[model samples]
Target: MTANERDNIRAAMDRLLAGIPLRSNGALTIVRLAEEADVKRHVLTHRHTDLKDEFYARIRAQGHVPDSGRRLRERLEQAEARLEALREENAELRAVNEGYARVVNLLTLENTELDKGDGARVVPLRRP
Candidate 1:
């Protein structure tokens, strides 16, 4: 990387670490770093790989989690919670449906028996 580019990257890194980003959202990620530096993302990932590594190392040393990573973890937890709720709801619905099916079957059998009883009670009359 050129000296000017390296300087810009370093300054951007400092700004990001300080949470005083001028050009980016200060998310503690490489993409945000590049945005802060006013450089392309490939410039940091491909050309200044050392700087990229240094940035990550510094973040780790400081026990800092990237905002994007934190957000993803939060989203995962929420999705898992939602999935569990849906599963419980599905189980309840299945049980209710089974109950309805049993009641319907019993009612049908009773109706059939009533029809048979009516037929048996009818008498044929012969006129004299």
Candidate 2:
């Protein structure tokens, strides 16, 4: 309807002009394209029918087979799976760092206590 909306639709269609391909978030389906452009599906059907037509036509022309449901979810699932793995790795690394910090703190505390031996600590002789 609006010029900005039209531009967003065109941008989305351009991504799919080569037919459905594997996009980073998901497969480049109509639904995902609309999501990418921050537009609704109805916008494509009611107002920007021209872009919609070109999108489907290009898919057919490009010899790229559509998914069975035309809603491939594997790409999104894979991305989420990787995110979860990275989160776990981050937690493990933080825990290891914390453990190292605790060890350093304990050693420092022990050195200080050792320096205060016999109740009255004596300064070590040092050359100027």
| Each prediction's TM-score versus the true structure | 0.72, 0.43
Question: lDDT, candidate 1, residue 66?
Answer: 84
Question: Least accurate stretch of 10 residues (summed lDDT) in model 1?
Answer: 114-123
Best by TM-score: 1
- Predict model 2's lDDT versus the native: 0.73
Per-residue CA lDDT of model 2 for 25-103, tens digit only, reads 4444667767766788788777778877877787678776666443456777788999999999999999999999999
Q: Which tens-of-lDDT digit does each residue in 1-128 have in candidate 1? A: 58999999999999999989999988899999999999999999999999999999999998998877898999999999999999999999999999999999999998789788857543689999
What are the clashing pairs of model 2? none
The local distance difference test score of each candidate is: 0.93, 0.73
Q: In model 1, state the lDDT of residue 26.
A: 88
Instruction: Give RMSD to native, each candidate.
Output: 5.5, 11.5
